[model samples]
Target: MFIESAGNSLRTIPGSFAVQPTSLQALFSKLPAESLSAGQTLILEGDVATSVFHVVTGSLRIFRILGDGRRVITGFLHAGDILGMSFKSHYIYTAEAITPVTIRRLSRKSFENEIAVSPDLGPAVFHQMSDEMAAAQDQMVLLSTKNAEERLCSFLLKELQRTLNAGALQTAVQLPMTRLDIADYLGLTIETVSRTLTKLSSKGVIETAGRHSVKILKRGKLAQMAGDGDEYEDDWRPATPQPERIRH
Candidate 1:
């Protein structure tokens, strides 16, 4: 399932996951659950991919460090997303909890065994991987073609759409990640993000409720600025409410 917003089809939202097969959910429920505080490291880049995690709650930042020690955020994961599904021996990026998080850890060996025997599990994993690739393609376009304001508009609209999926009120979009996190994820500087948002607010396109929330005064205007066309003009809601998709 996917959430369509402003012409972008997002397979999952921040607080919800794609529909898990009943068997899979049961399997996850039987696994051990672990909790981590905010800023805790869940997996490090280059570490052996020994476990796959099912996020039960909270948000995580997926990123990699450059040779010069710069951090590039690949994406953000929320509840219902899975982590450490690498085919390679090591994880490609580091995952850390940006908020307090709970996860169910499944050994890679067990995961592979289940996929081999469970008819539904393999297809679900494949679908998730495909959805991830599509999101990555969207991010590539945003970075290569969009200006700072356009990028911010797209990000904000996407956030609103994600919140809508979790059945939250459409009045305010929640942003759990900080500006620095947004900057890294969007490939812009923190100053640029702040400036662009301020610019939008001046135009009455959106209003910042606080550090962590935004209210859309003009959804169509914001969507237009995002270059997503008039798809958002009709209804502010998705045709079918879908669980959240992964950002990285």
Candidate 2:
């Protein structure tokens, strides 16, 4: 009972959520699909948390603006990610489309009511909240301990895993967000992000393809530089070096 819409399956990663997709589809499919062009705001911080959005395609940047006008990007959301999980009345962060995106919206009130009555849905949504917290903890560790180079390396590897999870190539990682977005997310300056990428390229761990894509030339080396060591070494290693190819 998978949630299928527009030829895409909205399935969570195994062990993350025990969702009954048939129920999820029934819960959300009646809602109309929403389309957002790149750079469009999907959810603004401090707005009433009226609904949650399920990403059908493309990417979004989740961030919060500080009182002094600085922005801190909390994370980037890709296909299958959900936003507006706050327990509070107002959203804690803003979600903006980084690429042309398609999503489905479900009112939080309706969602809460349904989950409260549905035994299976209750546990699934709880797991979803736990997953979000784990990701936030990981981001905190990345910012607190990692250097500029390590941060960028870790980011590329993360994007690589996301690419693979989407059933795409293991070596080519697409970065739809701008360097400034990455800088904000990782707590570094845009110049530092550029310089770190350049440094990685010189080391032959990665190569930039056009403005938005990167080819992982040496996964083992990049993972090593990321300092993940055995934690992700096996999962991050590439099967074989393939010819360079860039997607337009």
**Candidate 1 all-Cα RMSD:** 8.1
Q: Write the per-residue lDDT of candidate 2 for residues 90-203, one digit (tens) a residue.
A: 766677779988877666666667777787666666666666667678889999999888898899988887677666645778899999999998999999999989888898
Q: Clashes per prediction?
A: 5, 0
Backbone clash total for model 2 is 0
What TM-scores do the predictions have? 0.86, 0.82
- Flag regions of model 2 displaced more than 4 Å: 1-26, 233-248
Range of the 10 consecutive residues with the lowest summed lDDT in candidate 1: 1-10
lDDT of 1 at 15: 22
Query: What local distance difference test score does each model get?
Result: 0.73, 0.69
Residue 146 of model 1: what lDDT? 94
lDDT of 2 at 83: 66
Off by over 4 Å in 1: 1-24, 243-248
